[model samples]
Target: MWEKGYQTPIYLFNKLIGLQAVVEVVSNHTSNALELLAKQHSQMKTFVYQNQLALDYLLSECCIEIDDYKKTIRRLAAKIKKVAHVPLSKGCR
Candidate 1:
C-alpha cells in the first residue's frame, strides 16, 4: 500500500482494537431485538405489551427492580436508536 506506509491497528478495520470497537458497535446496535422493538412502543403490538410484561416480571420479580428496568430500557433504547438504523413507529421522548 503506497502512501499508506503504516497505519495503527486501531485505524484498520477488523483488526484488534478496531475489531473490538466493531463488535461493540454491532452489539450495542443489536442488543436484544425483542427488547429494542418493545422500546419502540409500536402500535402493531399494542406497545409490545408481551415483551413489556415479561421484562416487568423478570426485572421486578426476579431482580427486584421496580421501574428501574423501564429507565434502563429507555436508556438502552436511546443508545440503540442512536447507533442502529431502526424505524421508530411511535413518538419517543
Candidate 2:
C-alpha cells in the first residue's frame, strides 16, 4: 500500500498499522468471549494470550511512529519557511 505514490502514504500506513495493533490487542483480550460466541454460531475458536511484553512492543512502536511523523512535519515546515522567505530576482516583473 505504501508504494502507490500518494504523498501521505507513510502516514496512512502508520495509521493502519497502529489500528491493527490496537485491534489485535483488543481481540486478544476478548478471545474467550469471542470463542464462546463462535461456538454458539458453530464457527472456529480464537485464542490470545495476555502478555505484557507484546503490549509493550506495540506501544513502543506506536510511540516511535508518532515521533518520526512529528519530526518529518517539523523538517518540512522549516524547508517551507526557507522557500517562502526567498526574495524575487531583479529580472522578475
Candidate 3:
C-alpha cells in the first residue's frame, strides 16, 4: 500500500530546487578557480619572456668579450713570432 501523504508533489519540487542551488554554487566556484589559473598563467609567461631577454643580453656580451680576447691573443702571438728566430713548427726546443 502506497502512503499518499509521504509522496507529495511539493516535497519533490523542494528537493529539486535544493539540488539546483547546490549545482549553481559548484559552478560558481569552478569559474572562479579557472579565472585565477588564467591570471597565473599569464604572469608566468611574462616572467619567462623577461628572463629570456636577460639571458640573450648576457650571451651577447660574453660573445663580444670572447672576440676581444681572441684578438688580443692573436696580436701577442704575432709579436712573439717577430721577436723569436725559431719557427713555431719546430716547437721551441
Compared with the true structure, all predictions reach lDDT values of 0.55, 0.46, 0.54
Better of 1 and 2 by TM-score: 1
Off by over 4 Å in 2: 1-7, 32-93
User: Could you give candidate 3's per-residue lDDT for residues 5-89 as a string of tens digits?
Assistant: 5567766766766676666666555555555555566667667766767887977642211112334444454454444322323
How good is model 1 by TM-score? 0.29
Question: Considering summed lDDT, which 10 consecutive residues are worst modelled in model 1?
Answer: 61-70
| Regions more than 4 Å wrong, model 1 | 1-14, 32-34, 40-43, 47-93
Could you tell which candidate, 2 or 3, scores higher by TM-score? 3
State which candidate has the highest lDDT: 1
Candidates 1 and 2, the one with greater lDDT: 1
C-alpha lDDT (0 to 100) for residue 76 of candidate 1: 77
23-56: candidate 2 lDDT, tens digit per residue:
6555444554544454543322112222434666
Ten contiguous residues minimizing lDDT sum, candidate 3: 62-71
The better-scoring model by TM-score among 1 and 3 is 3
TM-score of 3: 0.55
Candidate 1 per-residue C-alpha lDDT over 14-85 given as tens digits, one digit per residue, 9 for 90 to 100: 254455556666756566664656555444354456667788887884333223254566667667656654
Which 10-residue window of candidate 2 scores lowest in summed lDDT?
A: 41-50
